[model samples]
Target: MSGTVTLGMVPVVLTALFFVLADGQITNDFLIAHLLAMGVPVIGPAAIWYWDARVFPTFVDQSADLAANPTAVQRVGDKYKAIFSTRSWYFVVPWIALIVGLTVLNLGFFETVGITGAGDPAFWVYLLFAAWWGLITGIGLHGAVTAVRAIRAVGELDLQIDPLHPDGLGGLSMIGHLAIWTTMLISLGSLALPLAFLLGTEGGYRAVVYLAVGVYIVVIAVSFVYPTVYVNRRAGEIQERELEKRREKIRQLQTQAANLEEADGDTGTIDEVATRLEIQRLRDEFNEYDSVSLYPLSVGIIIRLVSSLFLPIFFTLIDIYLGQLL
Candidate 1:
């Protein structure tokens, strides 16, 4: 993530240096815009990578416990390796295409905005800035994609479901937490800075900014939530199977108690009492299933996800409304 962000910033920094040497003065707005563009893409991925790095040891430890065999351990390592590896062309290609398309669109936008003048060095510089922006943004997006793929890969892991486990999902709860962090990384890294740039700009582009915000909300919501769906489904299935097993046990015990009651009188009373105790134990087991969440997302994660989407818009609105007042 750091390497990708650094590569993206090199062009802008070099361009800014060249312009400073040649023209002696660069427009403050242009500098600010380019810096924001470059910085926006870096923030989300950097934060996520930092988090991954910090928690990685814990992940490895948990993975080792889950992956009892050497093959499973190797697979777990491969999945982690894939998170940072650029070996996946399927992931890299779309980002490259997006960069190309956005570069063209931004060039046209600069031209339309009168920032691109014929044969002007400044215009070319601005175009380069746009391209750099797209490149970094693409890299950030690629990281997000990698994170999602990692989560999906986890779903394929041969995991043991221990019904007695405290987390209720057989210690696979880490997967859900990882999903939340990855979603946050994508949200803040990919969307926040660009939207900040758009909202900060002047003109009749408020409508454009709002439109972008709408798209950001929808995309982030999906990206954040979708990675957890498969895992959530798996958890639900496990919970259901466990519940069914307990229910079956309860039914058998009840049937035995009913038969004992119909058979005799005094001898059946002790048997019925023992059967009732067993039935109560099974019922407690069934009730414990309620403690197990099919969807691993907690209320806090949902709040954080919502906040990630709304906080930017909230501040943008403040800036807009307050700017009008001033």
Candidate 2:
């Protein structure tokens, strides 16, 4: 992981160094823009990989373990295989298509803005960088999908679900620790370099910022939330089954107690008393289910996760407005 990150950042660091070295000696707009373009793919993937290292350690660890032991065909292992297999076409195809589409759009935008001449080296450089950015973005997205799959695998594990536990999802609370929202935030942050370049020069391109933010919202929804839908549904099913079993037991106790009372014409008999106590115990057990959540996250945690997603957009708007003011 460290090696991948270091290697990925080499181009970006070199580009930055070049700009600094020529800071006062050169004033060519196309040259500087081309250098910045060269930095995009380099910085983007490195930032994404570093963020994943910090926020999604479980996914990283699992991936490493699977890579080390490819023959381990356990539940989680099989799912990991499926994630990287032909099923991954769903993610890969769309990613490539979007990249090609976006590259064309970007080229058209440059032409419309009169920023590129027909034979300009910067134009071709920008095209190359756009394609590179698309590839890196696709790689990051594939990682996100893998992380989601890892989260789902957690639910399939033989975890104990204790109704009395604080998290309400047994020890499966780690499912919430997936840091999905954090990952999404980091992914957005990786685009900061290119976004900064665009926003700095193109005053009329505020729409582009909004479009990026909107697309990020969709990505977050699909990557972070969509993958967990199955986990939530499975949890609910488990909760229902457990509750029904307990409820049936309680009902049986109640019926037995009533029969005892009818036979003796008295409610104070020992058998009736024992049956009542058992029913009370069963009811308490049944009520314990009330505390268990269908999903691993609490309301507070969910609110935090959601808030983190929008904070970037909020800050971006502020930056744009502040830029206008200045």
Candidate 3:
């Protein structure tokens, strides 16, 4: 996990550092414009983390003790389900930044570069960041889908209380950890893209930067999110099937329990049959729910990271080539 994060972030940190140092040398309005342009990409993910740390976490105390409480578990589960249901505030921030950032760019640079329009450098830059925002949002959407599927699957599982299975706590930890890291890496990488261009653009590169972001967003939204939605849909179907199995087990248990009580301890045969039936029924119910394990989380998390990583690498390389053109 540490290795995945380090490998993912090294390029971003290096890129940001390079951009920050190079920002000092750029003095022309066009060049300064490029530096400012780089910042647009960072807005959404940074805003997300800030909001989560400061605001979102306030709503739920996710401690182990809290989880142990049945009421807390239900409430927290509902809270998370609701949280992931809507398009997060993170998605809106990019558009806000784009409009606000471009407006400022327009007012300040319009006279020199002209207002954003066809074949205009500023227009292309705006488009680039817009694309980047879309790509990032799509990746985030995919991650959310993956996480939801994982959460639902785990929620369905009838974790054992025995010492041997340990209630499958290890599986839960693994899924949670995967989601957390994938979320962080994707966010960081999104920020690094524009930052790279800000420090490196020669001149007249803003449009190309925007163009790069724009193209990436199109590809990701079309390819990654759409298919992720399908996979998540299938996962939901599987979860539903497991839920039905549990319900059926519950029905069977209730019927047997009723028949045993009706016998009223008359014959030893009936008592023995009742006792054996109860044990089997209970075990069957437990196993029925236990089958809804963490497999979806594991698979979805892996897919999310793989796709998320692919987008950033593609954008970085494409943006580099675009910068060269400028």
Candidate 4:
């Protein structure tokens, strides 16, 4: 039998068309709400696409050969510094302006338009905070996490560039781990605001709205974080295996040199020297970060586990509340 149509693109398209058709008659308020609702699914795909296509590819697995004396780590930092100071500012400034503008307009709508009544102060308060938290949680977390991932990628590249530099490898690994933990803390903190709002709601429609919002938060968070942790662990394992192979090669070179030193012709001596050099390079690269190391695979696995464990409950709760919202 042919595969079932599990995808919902058709429905989405229909719904989108319906909204477009309703544009002339629907009030601006309802139109904006519908547009936002439609745009929600686009967010995940957009983030993932940008990260994989633009962000991750650019930074992940970045490396440099030792022939370039000073190494690539410093360049990575410089690249990020430029990004934050300029291109990042372009994206961020507009978001700040939009948020501030929307907030002011929303407040004015409530006050001058007299849409929100005095009797339901709680409802207004809930709406304001929810909207504020939603925007902050999305933009702040994305920017912060992107910065960290870029930094980590650069640090990893640094280690690969100069495996012999003691300070180079170890320092980068430490900094990368620090960035991961910091990212996690910030992410968790961002979620707390929405989660708290859900808890404080009077256990009805409003509560459901908060709950749906929270679920969306958890889904996106776990999706990104879990994959990262999995990839990290896998990378670490691969690194370990490569390290062993390099060590064996080094041993072989040492044995060859010992056997040929006394009776060997120049050709043997030259071959042994070449092998020794290659082994030395591998050893230096493999052991670059002696003091600090992280398994990318393990990190990826941990994040995946956390995501899987949390997502179901997160989604279920959100679904339950979302039903109420509708």
Candidate 5:
């Protein structure tokens, strides 16, 4: 985090120096917001990689029993390992181009919207901020792509129901928590957007900022939810598959129970009765497993995710509203 703050400070210091040297003033709000928005996106990928360090190993161990074959875990690990390679580093290059390209286009659009501040901003300000956003966004996209793909690779493994899991989420709550952590960082970054208002954008400029932020909010939410949705489908499939198997067994048990009257003697009748009782016992146990959860998340964790998405945005809005009122 401190390292990110340091990277964040580079733009702040340089932009400030440029504005002060050429124009004699800099907006404190833009300075703060500009630093914050870029910083948190960088932090998002770091948090993901940190969580992956732990989540990957634990997920591998927890899902061992559910894999289609003994080698399934190893196969998935190789796929995951591929992500750490230079081949994967290539992933960020295109993101940099896209983000920086958009930044350049927005600069042109903002020019038409009119610069409300001292003349037009120095070209240095444009170059520095755009490069910073491009770099941060590229790094963030790298992490987002890696995290989602790793989870999907795991999701492709055969899901066997594990009702007896201590977490009650089939040991998959870590995944839910991982996504929650990601979205929380994104939300925190969004809080910085409202502060950009302090930079003094007006008319079309304000509308564009709001539109971009709104679209970004939607994108972040989708990024956060996609993995959960993927894993959840796998969970439901496993539950239904396991339940159907037990239903087949129950049908067979019922057929065997119907034949009790054909037993050879009292001893045979006793044995037949015992077999029916045992099947009934087995059926009852699997029925419990069938009732287990079909999601890797708990109700409380879901609430946390919801809060992470809306609370910061709401708080920032209220702060802006009240500030305007005052």
Candidate 6:
């Protein structure tokens, strides 16, 4: 995290000089307009790469704990490593970035993108960042789809659910941790967007910023949901299946206790008392399984996601209100 999250800000400092000097458009609030905008791209790729490198490995490592068949689970782990490792998508994502950057350029924000603009040395920086940012977004799009499919594929493993696990999640509580951290990191990157809009020159980038964010919201929201959907389904299946078995066990115990009592006098045999105790234990297990949480989301993770998703917009609204008051 320090490697990715801390090192992620390096580009912010590197680009500060360029934005300050760019096109003679130097200003005191460079941090607000340009650094914030620049951070979106910088922090973004760093977070995405961090998720690809770090979180997934920790999740895949849990395969052994997930089941006794670590070797079979490791094959699924291999597929995960392969999905993230492939570079074939590298060639395609850039093309999409170029197309998007060109379209954003055509929106008339950067002097309509021509030779006249190229005469200014700073023009290329803006143009380059445009394509670079798009490249990051494209990679995000690809990562979102593949990550969801990768998570959904976990159901293919011959994994067993431990109904009596401590976490009450049938030994699968760790699966959704992948989504929680990555989405929060990317959402932190989004904290910059509104400042970029508020301080941007002459409201030129407003429409473009709004359009970019609308699309980003969809993609990020999907990223937020990917890790838990299949795991939640699997949890529900285990809860139902295990509860049925407990019911059957209880029925057998009840019948045995009945027979022992009929064979005994007014005072029952110890066997009858033991059978009743066994039936009560099975009933407790049934209630636990029946009341297992449907969604794998813990309150803490849900709160983290909500705050990450809403905090930027909340701050932006406050800033807007303050501006109106002033």
- Best candidate, lDDT: 6
lDDT for each residue of candidate 1 in 1-326, tens digit (9 for 90 to 100): 65646654566575565465334344444444445445654454456456556544355456456543536755665665665655545555576566545444444344443444446565656455555555555554565566566666655665545556666566666666666665666565433344344433643355655676677666667666777788777667766877899889999999999998887778788899999999998898788774666665666677777776775566456545644554
lDDT of 4 by residue, 45-130 (tens): 34333443454433433333321323465566456545643454455456556534443434423342223433444334434333
Model 3 segments beyond 4 Å from truth? 1-42, 49-66, 70-188, 194-266, 295-304
TM-score of each: 0.69, 0.64, 0.35, 0.40, 0.76, 0.76
> lDDT (CA) for every model shown?
0.59, 0.57, 0.46, 0.44, 0.62, 0.62
Error of 2 at 182 (Å): 6.6
Q: Assess the local accuracy of residue 264 in candidate 4 as a C-alpha lDDT between 0 and 100.
A: 60
**Shift in Å, residue 128, candidate 2:** 5.0
Question: For residues 1-326, what per-residue lDDT tens digits would candidate 5 score against the true structure?
Answer: 46645665665565555555444333444444555555554455455455456655565565666676737866775666566444544866676676556555455434432333334566446556566655555555555566677778778877566677777876667567656655554555565465444332532356666776677678678767898888888887877777788788877877776687586789768877887887887688677777676666788778877886785477468547744664
RMSD of 4: 15.0
Output the better candidate (2/3) by lDDT: 2
Clashing pairs in 3: 124-207, 125-206, 125-207, 127-210, 128-210, 128-211, 129-210, 131-213, 131-214, 132-213
Write the residue-wise lDDT of candidate 2 on 1-326 in tens digits. 67766756655654445345332333344344445445546666655656455545554343333232323324564465456544546765677676555545555445543435435554444444445555666666676677676666655543335676655664345455564543553445433434443543553545665676678766766665665577677667766777899888888888888888877645448889998998888788778775676565667657766765665555556445644554
Sort the candidates on lDDT, descending order: 6, 5, 1, 2, 3, 4
lDDT of 6: 0.62
Each candidate: RMSD to true structure?
A: 5.1, 6.6, 15.1, 15.0, 4.4, 4.5
Candidate 4, overall lDDT?
Answer: 0.44
* Consecutive 10-residue window with the lowest summed lDDT within model 2: 64-73
lDDT of model number 1 = 0.59
Task: Name the regions of candidate 1 deviating beyond 4 angstroms.
Answer: 1-12, 15-31, 41-45, 51-80, 88-90, 93-97, 100-132, 156-172, 190-213, 257-276, 311-326
What is the lDDT, from 0 to 100, of the residue 48 in candidate 3?
A: 45
* Candidate 3, 1-326: lDDT as tens digits: 34434433433443344334332332344444344334434444553444344323432332222133545445554565455545545554564565445444443333334433345454444444445544445434544454445444434433322212333432233333334443543444454464445433433457766676666555444433433344345444544655566566767766666677676446845775766677676566556444544332455555665666565666567555655665
Pairs with steric clashes in candidate 6? none
